[model samples]
Target: MEFDVKGKVKEYYGGIARKVNNGSGKSCCSGTSCCNEVSKTSLIYNGESLTYLPKEALEASLGCANPVVFAKLKEGETVLDLGSGGGINVLMAAKHVGTTGKVYGLDMTDEMLNLANSNKAKMGVTNVDFLKGYIEDIPLKDELVDVIMSNCVINLSEDKERALSEAYRVLKEGGRLAIADIITLKEVSTELRAEANMWCGCLGGTLTIAEYKSILENVGFKDIEIEVAHIYTKSIIENTYLKDKDLDDVANKLNLDEVDGAFAGAYIKARK
Candidate 1:
């Protein structure tokens, strides 16, 4: 990734983290265009109580699926969560990994780290640690992690190859990478691709499924599987309007446009 692109993502998401962490009513899940149902449902499904996280942490959740559950993590193994926004999945992984194991939440935003740290305190969980860094260049030692998980974050990396390589480097032999994110089934229009807000919001910057797989393969990861679990076009169109009501009325009234070859959510599981 270019320095500017990386910096843009960091700044974009960092501002988002700051907004939601402050307990404002502003929605991070498209800020209004998308329905909150998915977020609410995912939280309940993931076993998060309303008391577990702050309002902003809850609001700022942008994950399309639960990577913690998809990862099949076990107790007493070290787990690392890339782009651990607001510590949602990090906290969940922490509980699942138990005190015998350690969970590391690596994120680039200082505000997000602070929010995640506060959530840790609120939950009384002492087994997790939040670190400041980019996922493309993880701060952990090579071959030290048992599992790597991320939620809708890697696609935004300016250098996804570096991110995947870092993921592989930080994992133990036979370690796995389980990610729940957005992926395109075909080519997306350049217009949509150029939207910085959409890109940062986990929409515009996504890779094609084949590209995602190829990158994992290039990084020496095997048994790569990318599954489409959720189709969020309806929700995205909904969010498009909800997040930015100013879009043309005709555009607003039109149903969510199928991103042609786009899948709302995808799960990628690979092994070192």
Candidate 2:
């Protein structure tokens, strides 16, 4: 059967919103052992950064890295977070931009939007607004935002080129792009790429570093820089995606040992 990529994505993330609302305090993406391990060690956020935000925001954070930390947002600057799930990055950006600046969190899922808005209200954060929209076609005016931030969400897009183009379209001249996302160092197998679970797990849709940088450059972004934040080891994948599966079958298809340097959590920085 063919996979409904878009429908699966919504179903996967919408469930995450519901779980957070139920006080689960568990990240949907980190439900597996491999993901849990990565979350504890790979993702970075200062204690002070999490202190002022609603607890729900921290619980719902599914980012591979903290884009807000790399964004270096200034007070009074307008920032937009594409695919801002549960509003963690958006809230962080709001604090950085202050009362004078506005932060917009654009997400496609209604559940996430509701959860984000609830968090916003709880925190009394007037500077941030969560909107419903797709990353490929952002629901904002062109050249309006000072910076565009995203967290591990872009790789999920089926049309990455269009998404990056939209990101460029919404940014002001000289505006910055700070994103934390997954990238692949080597090509994955066709079988793995076809796995819906892997795609939703932030693995299947990843582009190689060269492809990622090229896409940004093609979208008219300059000063592009990609920093490797964390590399996923074979054991991590085995624990998460390959657990209880036929290890030799996968190894034969994808060469597990050769995939040592394959996957990474990348911090991507660029300018429009």
Candidate 3:
């Protein structure tokens, strides 16, 4: 049997975008469950800067960490957000960049793209543009972006190396990479790696912190730094996905406990 990793990811995220558009469902793939609304709000976006945007935009967000917070966009700087689900980060970055700066939101799913555009219309944000494309192959011109940001998105790519390479290509001479993604703290087992559900839920396809650094270095990025923001505990893992025997499998493999951090939400920063 063949497992369609990319198809599963697209289907899962496309479903999320549609659900958000229809004002139903919640984010379940960001390590923290969006169905747990209170925790989702506090854990992801805690600032008041995004209050002016459409409520649905915030509700549609499926990010792990606030990359825009870590991005620290300056006015008049061009920014690009890969996999800009619902345009939360893109809109937020637009605010930080002011009117002079331009922000591009790239997503492969048409459903997500439509939802993002709908949110853009609701907010009347002129500086943001939602593009349709894959992270592995960005649609923008080369050496065009001053800052590149993504939130919990890069890890979903089946070919992470290509995705990172594309990220590096779009960045300007002194561009920065401020992204939030899931990084594994432990080695993944063969069984877990083959689990499509885990992959769709932000677990199966991931890299170690060291692997990220090495890839960035090879991609000609400098000043690389990665910090663990939130560790996905046994309870969190259980609550996030698979409420059945799958939980038992993950527990047995990771040997979950309070002290054992199997995976973490990390803030990765680098300069091109």
What tens-digit string does per-residue lDDT give for candidate 3 at 128-158?
A: 9999999999998899999999988888888
| Residue lDDT tens for model 1, 1-272 | 22366666777667767766664434434445644533563553463444545555566666667787778889998999999978888888887889999999999888788878987888889899999998988998989889999988988877889999999999999999999888877666666666555556566678878899899999899999988876656565455423532234323433246463355578899999
- Model 1 off-target regions past 4 Å? 1-3, 27-56, 240-261
Candidate 2's TM-score reads: 0.87
**What lDDT does each candidate get?**
0.75, 0.82, 0.81
Best by TM-score: 3
Please name the candidate that would achieve the greatest lDDT relative to the true structure: 2
Q: Give every collision pair in model 3.
A: none
At residue 66, candidate 3 shows an lDDT of 88
Q: Write the per-residue lDDT of candidate 2 for residues 1-272, one digit (tens) a residue.
A: 27877787888788878877986545433445433422442336753346677777776677777788889989999999998888988988898999999999999999999999999999998989899989988999999999999988899999999999999999999999999999998876787788776666777789998999899999899999999988889876666444322133444455567567689989999998
* TM-score for each of the candidates: 0.84, 0.87, 0.88
Task: Between candidates 1 and 3, name the one with more favorable TM-score.
Answer: 3
- Cα deviation at 183, candidate 1, in Å, is 0.5
lDDT of 1 at 256: 48
Q: What is candidate 3's local distance difference test score?
A: 0.81
